[model samples]
Target: MHEPDYGVAGRTAIVTGASQGIGKAIAETLAASGANVVICSRAQERVDPVAEAIDDECEGTALAVECNVREREQVDALVDATVAEFGGVDVLVNNAGGEFVAPFEDISPNGWNAIVDLNLNGTVHCTQVAGEVMRENGGGSIVNLSSVNGQHAAPGESHYGAAKAAIIRLTETLAVEWAPHGIRVNCVAPGLIQTPGVAETLGIDSEQMPEREEVDRRIGHGEEIADLVQFLVSPAASFVTGETVTAKGVPKPGNSMSEGLGLE
Candidate 1:
């Protein structure tokens, strides 16, 4: 198999929700690949460390901004700062997102709104602001992070899944509308991957890591996800717009019960 190269060097990219998890990974990978990357989260302190780490490793410059993407004003300022720092934008990764694990019935208005404001609305605000700069620059790439729960709803993830699903639709719509402006918008929905959050949430460690990686599972690696993201933002995927690329591992054909072996 031929390995893909994500040609993002010298290009300016803004990654949101980049203080930790997949967002942080994406920022690091982009920086390593030679992109003039800027990242933001809810606070500058949290993102400063991330920026420092990237600066220590990346071939290009990294900037950290304090931004809460759920608000349009913050997103606007984020774009302006990025433009001032790097001149223009070439890639916009709308990766700042989270979910609340509550049953559909238990999802209060405020709780549901919080999840949507961050996941869906946050993405929208970033895309709008970033797209403006990218449109002015002729063309750019926008990679929206989604989830399998959006495709196959998992219990207690109602708000999260719905927001992600809307993102898919938004990707398609924006792809069509923005193609004329020379912008390519796409989505990447990842399967269960090993992250500190997952491990801590489930209270599992090395001993259970392998068990969770059984043949029938759709687990994946963070680096693998980063690789795909790198591809999407790179010139290699010039024709890959309006698509939702799933990065989950192969799911077995057997039923859940068939794959169940923890008791054994």
Candidate 2:
């Protein structure tokens, strides 16, 4: 008659791109579960309010840091700040990423590089930096944010799909390589979630999203994704690693190009 234990209370975690959207939801969810959370974004102004809000409402403490995950130095500083505040890192959520829709041929080299750097290189930087602390501390969990587009064909988002696909491969490899160190690595590929960015870019609002119960080709919510992330990083999933969990609603049998173009 015992319930599954999350084992996150009092642990320390860092969630990147936590200023808003999926990242913000993950941070708030973890903090509510009693994990001291450090939330970061590219600008101090962007993440400060989120940290303050988490502090006000959650059981755990929240720290705000300005970090561009593409920069190794910034990633180092973010990890250092986390360790200084909470002693060590027990979890990392690599959620900082961005992309724009354009045909493969229309994408400029600079544009392609920017998207790849942010989505793929940024994850590499954070994982390497925070992973060092996790290794030293005997073990930790890392959850990466990917998208459904990575698994399917993306007509207008070739760069983004490529980067995200790389993340999945990286997760699998790292999971195997780091298993001996007691570290666990996993990836979450979410489908069309109604984040603010999605609302802006795709004209899809949470109000328009179907209820969770009506699970046929519906948009998802950040909280639902957050809940999945929480479980993945918690003791409940102790035996799970090197896996990519897709949280998109049930797939339909047709062209999904339009859906992939606006994946958030």
Candidate 3:
């Protein structure tokens, strides 16, 4: 096994959306670093391969559960399965989410509710349930995946942006509320990265190659994001809580577009 800052050896973790992309990477990394990990996505078959692959390579135990976090029953079972297998959860990564980009007027109630339920309500369910277990077993850490879009609104993702923004506030609130119980909550708000979902949304082609290249050349990677997450959950970050750690390439300029374009 690889040496990791997190003496994650034997620490049990539950990472949502762990079938692919950023969540997959986080699960794999955590397992490699010595944490017994429980990972879930909505698909059992799809996630089973990831769990098997992780178990083969990492020192920690891995389990893949098919859980649609939007459903409370499944989310409860996901947590229950983890506790049954690993004894308890030490880290919870709320990484399962989806987005629907459309003109605000064109967004149907279904579209809006789905995003709200998965991103915001899903986080709520997982954190609430997992916090209860962690509180009983002893306190733990929660790392939520928000987005930079939450901080900077864009053309067609009003719903996604709103949900992500709420995650930031929710992180802060959970930190305060759960602190007394010995749990720490933090959020990671990432800028553009070359993930499948992101690429698909951008109509990724030669025209978008420059943007993708720029992000690769400047922004973060799934592994790097996982590294930060490892730190935030480890004792190294005991002092850090209720903070929205932005993982953008540049320090946010803090200036409005109007100011930059001289429209002000």
Candidate 4:
């Protein structure tokens, strides 16, 4: 009997923002599965250790590249380095983004621009560069990391939410435009994934954390998101494209204020 193959082993994959968190998990997962991985972030110091660790644990190769996705030149350099090291590109994951929590009125124009540039334009840089390599290679998979805020209201994160929502539309458009090139594009929207960095950012002490099931109600692990990314890039999802998979456990309804901005 012929069995199913994920078609990931021996592939070359570039995962941006992979110095830690979900991006690191995804890079590790792909390396362990025998895919040569190029992991990058804004600082070489941040990515070198991750590459070293993956190289030690996985049979496949891992290359560390320093890239600030917001800069198109740096992004192009990153793709060039990946091609030089791995020979070609097969998968690209756009996972670098950050946002600050504040009321819309309190957010400065510069602050809003920073979020949009990092979240939306950063994705554009990586996708366009990597897509070029994919085109030359005949096909590839691109998975973007969005956020649940893109779909729902985030009172304190309006800028980030808007950028992520835009990413969803970009994924759809690219999926269609690149279909002829055999490239697939998709998005993953995660909410409150539990990581050391995230905990520190949110001022949550790890010592007081509950069990996995309890915590998973409101927060998930980076590995959970990594798994979804793997599936999206694997042959199992060959028929899947231009979709946004939300990984925020179960949804719970909430009461809305009487008059924020009525849709009436």
Candidate 5:
């Protein structure tokens, strides 16, 4: 019997928002799988140390670039730098996004635009830019990061939910359009993953989280999401595209949105 192959060894990948949290875990996971990874964040100083750490600890190479995915020029530069350093792009993970707690009526126009820009427009910019590289290089895989709020009602995150929902639609459309180019597009909608950002926002610590073996696991870890991303981008999931894998643990009865957001 033969074991399944990840098919990521020696390939080149780009992971955005890699300075911390789930993005950082994805970058580390991919690099450890023998894929030369380009990790980028809006701040050079923040991402540089992560790149160094990955270089020292992982099996593959790591390149750090400062890029805000909302900027088209910056996204272009990021892809160019990746191609120059790693020769070509085989995988692109759009993981840069942000949102704040605000009810629909309380959300200002500026706030709405900001969340949508970062969460939706950012994904668009990165996907289009890196997707071109993939098109030219024969084929590649793209994994988009969304949120479970996209699929369900988000009481205090209306803008975020809207943007994330758009990403899911975008992924499905892009998958069909890019199929002829040998490019695959998919999305991951994570639910309550324990990351630095989540810790700070929700005041939930790792020690407070339930264990994986718990009968009612409510929260998840970044590494768990990273593993899913690795499989999606690797050949093991070659047939998986235009799909949004939601990693939220088994839902509990009568859990409110505010409770999930840690407002309870």
Candidate 6:
């Protein structure tokens, strides 16, 4: 029997915020699968080592670039650098975004704009710049990272939810607009994921959670999201676009109940 091909080999992919967590996993996963990966974060120091490590361990190449997606100049440089290194980009993952917990009334204009700039505007910058290259190259895939809060309520994270929700709409619109260019745009909405940052924020150790049988029922790992992203960008999902894939694991029976509605 012939082995199934995910069809990412020899492709060049750029993943933003790839210094850690879901972004890191996606970069490494793509590199390991024979796709030349360009990993970027706001700091060169954080992403350089990851690039070197991928070079040592993976079958494909890894390049590290420092970029703040909110800035169009830096994002342009990142795309140009990737294109210079690997000819043209075949996949792009907009995975850099953040938000602070605060009530709607407490959210300052600057704070709200900051979150929206990072989550929504940032995606716009990267997609537009990268889409141009992909359009010229005949085809490519673009994946935007969203959050489950965008679908449900996030009391203390209203700004975050709003920004993520905008990303969903942007993904759908871009998918249709770019279809003629063969550029597929999609979004991934991940619920609770077990990562160091999340663990620290929640005052729980994810390292220890796996030792318990509850691991199966607990939050997912960054690798799981990476797996979904891998599929979405690969040939396995050629027919998929303008879609939001939620990787939140199984929902509890009472999640929709009033008593179960609570913020993280």
TM, every model: 0.89, 0.91, 0.89, 0.90, 0.90, 0.90
lDDT of each: 0.87, 0.91, 0.86, 0.88, 0.90, 0.89
True lDDT of residue 229, candidate 2: 97
User: Which residues of candidate 3, in runs, are more than 4 Å off?
Assistant: 1-5, 205-219, 251-264
Residues 197-247, candidate 4, lDDT per residue (tens digit)?
566655667544444343424467788898889889999899999999999
Off by over 4 Å in 2: 203-216, 251-264
Instruction: State the displacement of the C-alpha of residue 25, model 6, in Å, after optimal TM-score superposition.
Output: 0.3
Over 4 Å off, model 6: 1-4, 200-217, 251-264
When 3 and 5 are scored with lDDT, the better candidate is 5
**Local lDDT at 135 for model 5:** 94
In candidate 4, list every pair of residues with a backbone clash. none
Top candidate (lDDT): 2
RMSD of 4: 5.3
Per-residue accuracy of model 6 over 1-264 as CA lDDT, tens digit each: 866558688999999999988899999999999999999999999999999999999999999999999999999999999999999999999998777788999999999999999989998999989989999999999999999889889788999999999999999998999999999999999988877656665566867655554333357888999999999998889899999999987644444532354521
For model 3, how does the per-residue alpha-carbon lDDT over 203-238 read when each residue is reduced to its tens digit?
Answer: 665335445433423545678788888889997788
All-Cα superposition RMSD per candidate = 3.8, 4.8, 4.6, 5.3, 4.7, 4.2
Of candidate 3, the 10-residue stretch with the lowest lDDT total is 209-218
lDDT of 5 by residue, 122-200 (tens): 9999888999889988999999999999999978989999999999999999999999999999999999887777766
